[model samples]
Target: MSSFRLITEYSLWFILPALCVAGAYSWLLYSKKGPWSPLLNKILFSVRFILIFLLCFLLIGPLLQYIKNEFEKPIFVFAIDDSESNTISTGVAKLSALKKEIEQAKKILQQEDYTVDIVTLSGKLSIDDITFKNPSTNLDYLLDKVESNYENRNLAGTILFSDGIYNQGLSPAYKELGFPLYTIGLGDTAAKKDIILKNILYNKLTYQGNSFPIVAEIQNQGFEGKDITVIIKNKGKLLDKKIITFSRNYDLKEVEFRLTSDEKGLQHYEIEVVPLEGEFTDKNNTGHAYIDVIEGKEEILLVASSPHPDIKAIKSVTDQKENYSLNIYIPGITEFKNEKYDLIIFHQIPDLQNTAAEILNKYGKDNSSIWYITGNKVNYASFNQINNALKISQRGQQLDQVTAVYNPDFNKFSLTTEEASVISKYPPVSVPFGEFKPMNNAEVILFQRLGNVQTVKPLLLFSNANDKKVAVFSGEGLWEWRLLEFKETGTTKVFDKLIGNLIQLLSSREEKRKFKVYPINSEFYSSDPVLFETEVYNDIYEKIYGQNINLTVTSEKNEKKHYSYVNTENSRFEIKGLSQGIYKYVASTILNGKKETSEGEFLIKELNIELINGTSDFDLLRTISDKNKGVFLPVTKLSSLPEILKNSSPQSIIHSNEELSEIINLKWVFFLLISLVTLEWFFRKFKGGY
Candidate 1:
């Protein structure tokens, strides 16, 4: 429905002046005619008057307003599950019949003045597009798409048909849905005889020669007192095997395999359960996992003046990490090698007797990281000589007890709020009474708190001396802090975190290179995208792009595939549709007239989640229907869906829209003005008036 009205900012009285002026002009021009008769003269005068009046009236800039109302029919969505599980129990013929019934129901709804649309897992379906070929099922993703696409529209409800076997996304049960949901159940609901490898648990990373355990769960059904053999393998070589006896019809047994990490890089392991006769599909009997085994661990050296509890405290935290190997040395007591280490700790070393001058001078020149824990026994003269970043001037050999005051502005590393709070309650330790001085390059992690007064003196800080990372702890009794943390929290989490963060920050070094490329991940599923990231830098180590990088992937069968990708600083190169195997890749590029390359290995495994359990779950369908205030039925009752929707009283919505346009801008108005002027001139000429 639509309506039109003429509007103006000025009053209607303004158009009368335009009318008077036109009439006077027309009368003056035609009153004294040469050869025309009075009747013809009057007709010409009237046409001239109307045409002139319209031109003058347009000065007021009148506008034409139109209001339109549109009525939209209620929309109904019929969604179907297009996953492989739908055809597992019901063959293609039966599934095709079900699609016909759904189409008939949609036509009926359309005849009843309702807009109906059919959709599948991917999107809106064509006439013959329901093939049940999608590899996985995600009903939750389908529902989310419907809700987002039809939000605030004339959508009345949705009708879903599925077997309720979703393995990709969150369960669609009990979630708040704006529209009513009606579900049609499919697939066989009876339990079948099958053996499934349900799950596998293992570590994702370990060092070389370390033993790691993998546990696989074998779920048995309808095979009581039957023995099943489980085996694990790597690269087609058997590593271990086990036999499990199921005592009941439905039982779950766990099999464990402990294997040494012999080879470096990404390692793929496959676990399988031997199939038995009369058992359900063997597609779900095998499972796979990958572990990344690194070649070596970082070596840390701990040098001390004497055997103190602080040394034990630091060693206890470092021992928990598998990537760090620690060695303790007393300069005079034991013979030590002057080997290169990742990090060195000096605990009250550089004392009056043993300064460790030879060890410090050698490692210091090598730019190795070092941490200094100072106490009352520290020799200020020798310690201050090591680095001028921090200096202590003793006053008569006095001692002061100081607690920790955390600094929130420290950005070197991160510490949790709970860890900071726990540090505040730690017991104070003895420090030399003196005037403490720290250089401008020092970043203080913790300051000294003297009896409830926070001071500007550094208790724990980090600084760089001649390109070597250095840390200083200005007090003793770290063991006390660890004990207090465990006693209050039943664990040493806070203490361990503080020490771990410190070690990580001081030991880590950035490796900057030019023209490098590697895969983003070492392991991926067949459905997952294979992506590689690249970095091309100039001589000064600034990221540069526009270089062409060539990649070569060699499969286990010696088949090589080559691809060339243009490098972008912010994006990754994506490769698609590679089958299941272990692949070795080499990425090479030329920058600044030099050839550089990087090589790595990755594994692609197949996903069989849909075949793990093929039994139908009608109870899940009913729960979804009831939660959204709708109905659930089997596939046979699909013909009754139109009647149920019609009884629900879906209403049509009317949307009102208003449009305003200037009257002078209308095309018809311009044409009408030209026609009137032309007619008046033609009549005058025919009447013999020039």
Candidate 2:
């Protein structure tokens, strides 16, 4: 059962050194020899010289002998691992103890005549004469290597030392190898107390007059049922703050905030959550968002011929917002400047006898929103001359028998058979109007015929003629609703919304008088084409125009791109797919030159969402190991891994069994010696030694 293994690598140069030593010894012995000597003495001296020469050869390091007791039984391989994570806790101590245990096991195996192969499975594996580098601590890979290498040898068992964490290589099933897994876990299992801001989200851009929302998610670990505060700020001003409560155990909470733009350019803001005690990192607690607020203030010019409450009501609403600057010019006011307004409203203006029609035609040809309100005091013939779409005819007298009712229910308003078809294609809304003559070159928005009334006309209509937009209202019943049901039902909000909807429509149409261009960001380059858009609406929120509109662009630099409007429902016109840079655009309808000019500016900005730190506790690693029947050892148990592996006997198997005669060839050694001796004797006989 005991055996010695010798391993040596010698070159032909070694033979030269042996020859020199032999020559030197022979000279020293022969240099002192007498010329004549007894034959017996000579033979004795020769035998002694041969023995000395063999001893000298042994001392020259021809080969090295490693002797040890080898067990006649099968061999078992012990693999030990040393990796970075294994040093987390008592890993070093565990590894040392495991080494001692393996040594003891080896001694036991030797005494029992059982072969044992000691291998270190650190970053790699090392056997008696073979070594593998950077070998993963994964027991599966190591076992597979062993199984393959020792396929024809008798392998009694295998022992592995490692920290339970197997970060590299596939985790194989111990059952597949027909072995048991004894995993030694390492590292601390206590959850580290920490708080993290999981995520943040917000809109990239917003209009100057609009408000946007921001959302964020926060997660807490080790602290539950706790209240946390989140705060949002712009520049140095505190915008909003909220307190949120977290559920017991680790919980993820969501928070939302609203932000409104105040200027006509870029608005920057920061959102952050107040950190709790023992929070891990503050990097994730805060984030920044940027929004571009476009300038969209529209100038409206009012030209009312007669004093009326409707104009005052409309002015009151329009003038209340700084965004809408209203310039009123009633009839008989000749000193008013004509070019100062974006929209012109005509109230019961009977005629254009004082060059007013010429001025209006000029303005209309230049593209402007013109609103006409019909009344009894107006000369319909003269007004029709300027805008013939009104189709006004002379009447013998002004009739006052018509009484308008406040209809709260939108369904009660009856539409003519022809008008019903158009109304059916759109979203339904309550419309208020009086009967008027339907004219050619005009699209009717609303229609109604009073009972016993001879005249039946369009209540509302839009006309595109001579590159001009004309909007006509047949009757005035808007205030009646506010006074009657609005006051009775106390649903003032609904009434306000209705009025707001109407105003939004009229103002949006008038916005085409000037082009408004907005940049996507503050740092926008001047070479980029600005984004141009507008919202089109009717007085009653009824969408009269498609969301898709057309815009003719002209820049100070003489650049142009025809943009087709994309309808974003709710009367918004969006012109997308634009190049980056500064530009001036005139947005308008193709039928009319009415355009709103605005400067375009945009800056390219990159938004980044930070990654969540650490990992989830779903135990994905454990699941993977369990699925493969591999041992899942915590980082802390890595120290005692050797003992655990030893207990498992993971490598207990016979890789191969072969007869001793196959390994050792005694016949070959004897044959080599006989051949050398025969040659030597033949040389001596040829020299006539007899």
Candidate 3:
């Protein structure tokens, strides 16, 4: 409801003219003495006077002040935890009781005219479904969701029902939610008689017939003087076994197991601990890992005109890998056994002495991939004729000291974040001072940077052209790069990874599929997205779009599901969530009116960090509530929380305002003046005074 009033502060400016016009009109009417009676004359004069006065007074603008009350119900929200730990921490009863309390709270809030929303936090927030089996809890992700949903709103407060057991990311104590937060701690703090398989560690790749050690850690609580047997098995075949004795109530033990890999391809191993008398949560008692065993060693041929430290540096790294057998041959001494090789690395090969061309022709004609490393000794003109991947034109024997700058668009494979950083800081290498031009399609990993100017010239790259895989390193000083890497990081893993990645990319078999569908990451965690990307090329190797591909996923339990995905702008698709298991997929599409199919397998590992420490982190919960102007309510005290909110919400909507402007437009003034003048005219005509 609203009220209106005419603003009369400036009425004095219009009042004088109104009175003068009224009196003048009265005189004009009275001056004309007519046959009408005195009463008629007075009435006529009064009508004319009122009409004239109204016309004069309307010159001043009038305004109406209007106010309205808007009732806005306060928004109240609840985020409930539904992770696997909920069932472990005396939470079954508390969760049941809390559900009842929540129903009661919803009724009270609705009756009090509050907008309520309840969501379940099971590694994510959901309103219609609840799954308490999520393996991990990410409090940071949950809080971020809450902020995104209620920011800039009258979010009176929020209620969180969780066990304070977060295993993934930042704790809740560090968040500034900008509103009141009330937490109800679930789970028990009492230690129980339990045993857990904490973690398993092993190399992800190994060679056939090689023995690799697997390390695992176990934790025991309240199981003193008890012996448990741990067994390692692959495909249900026993590999190794050990018995561990827990001497103390709470103990952590690290054990090692050595097993021989006799098979090829991906292998799965399960490490399990025999349960004691009364352990109920058997999920965490077993750990598993996967290792890929290569069948045989692959030979790599290294050709250089003479002895150099760079060759020694490269040899040291390749010798450590059991899968690659490296052979080095200087031009004058001996010839490399080109009998059967997987890859060949040529260092400054087309020299002014012209000694390395015959060896280059011997191995380069074959289908095996080649890597070219150039330095001051490389003859630029002869090098251009030998390789068609890149062309360069420079001044006579001038050298360029170029540092390595990583290219962000390299997507062939991946380099660790730490390795990229280390390579960027190492000393510069010597390249020809010239204009470098690449004529073929190349995926560059490192670019050349002279001083501070980053250039587009490729310092290290991989290319696939004319049915051959070629990699190029346009400069050298790898020996310096290796020594600097070791001096700084105290290990050559970073450098080895850099070179190893290039070797793997160039040495791997080429893909001949026209219609291809592959996962961005073959190995995924339960916390990560299952992402797939596709590539469909026409006859001439040009990428085409608008392809409809059908896919079927089969789980280890033989459950199969079908899905269809058309390409996005980037030719990608995603399944945002999946359970932990081994999944194989077959993707097929109609290309050129023929069906083409590609199949692959991917693994999703479960993240059980939240279940390791099952005790309640009540201190973290208290810190969150204390800093956010809220109350920390335990499960026993949860009933009193709604009462606190009830007391605080009376001032939820203290006031509101609105606008109404019907009279302020001044249209009513014109209608009132016309009505008075019309009435006077009708009366004059009836009294025969017209």
Q: Pick the candidate with the highest TM-score.
A: 3
Report the lDDT tens digits of candidate 1 across residue range 1-690: 898988986887889999998999888987786587788888888998998789888887788999999999999998788888887755678899988888899889999999987778956476377788677889988898889889989999999899888888889995779999999998888898989899999987898999999999888888778889999999889999999989987688889999997799878788999998988778789988888899888889988888899988999999999789888888778667666688998888778775677886776556788898987668788888875468888898788899997899999887878778999999998888888888748889999999989999988998875567888898888899999888888999888988999998888874557867778887778777899989888887788899999999988667999999899768999988888878999989887788888888888877667777778889999999999988998887888889999999999999989999988899999999989988987877886676
Candidate 2 per-residue lDDT, tens place, 325-380, comes to 77777657635665656567776664434435555666645666677776655665
Q: What is the C-alpha RMSD of each candidate to the true structure, in Å?
A: 7.8, 27.9, 5.9
- Residue-level error in angstroms, candidate 2, position 227: 16
Q: What value of lDDT does candidate 1 attain over all alpha carbons?
A: 0.86
The number of the candidate with the highest lDDT is 1
- lDDT, residue 630, candidate 2: 47
Which has the higher lDDT value, candidate number 1 or candidate number 3?
A: 1
**Model 2 RMSD vs true structure:** 27.9
Give all TM-scores, in the order shown. 0.70, 0.35, 0.76
Residue 442, candidate 1: Cα error in Å is 11
Please report, as a residue range, the 10-residue window in candidate 2 with the lowest summed lDDT: 422-431
Candidate 1 clash pair list = none
* Model 1: ten consecutive residues of lowest lDDT: 122-131
lDDT string for model 3 (1-690, tens) is 455555643665778878898889788777788667888878778878887776666555544556666566798788777777877775556566667777787778778878777766653444335546777788777777788888877788888878888888887888998878888888776666789899999998888999999888999887778888899988778989999998886789988999888877677788998878887467678888888788878888888988899999989888888778899988678666656778889988877787678878876676769999988888888888877677778688788898998786798877767667888898999988878887678778899989999899988888888778888899879899999988987998878888887888887787878988889987999878888888888898788888998999887667888889787566468775677677889999999999999998888887777567677777778888898888888878876776888888644563446554534356776677777788877877787877
- Name the runs in model 3 displaced over 4 angstroms: 1-74, 91-94, 123-128, 175-177, 296-341, 355-358, 399-437, 440-462, 475-504, 515-517, 525-597, 648-650, 654-690
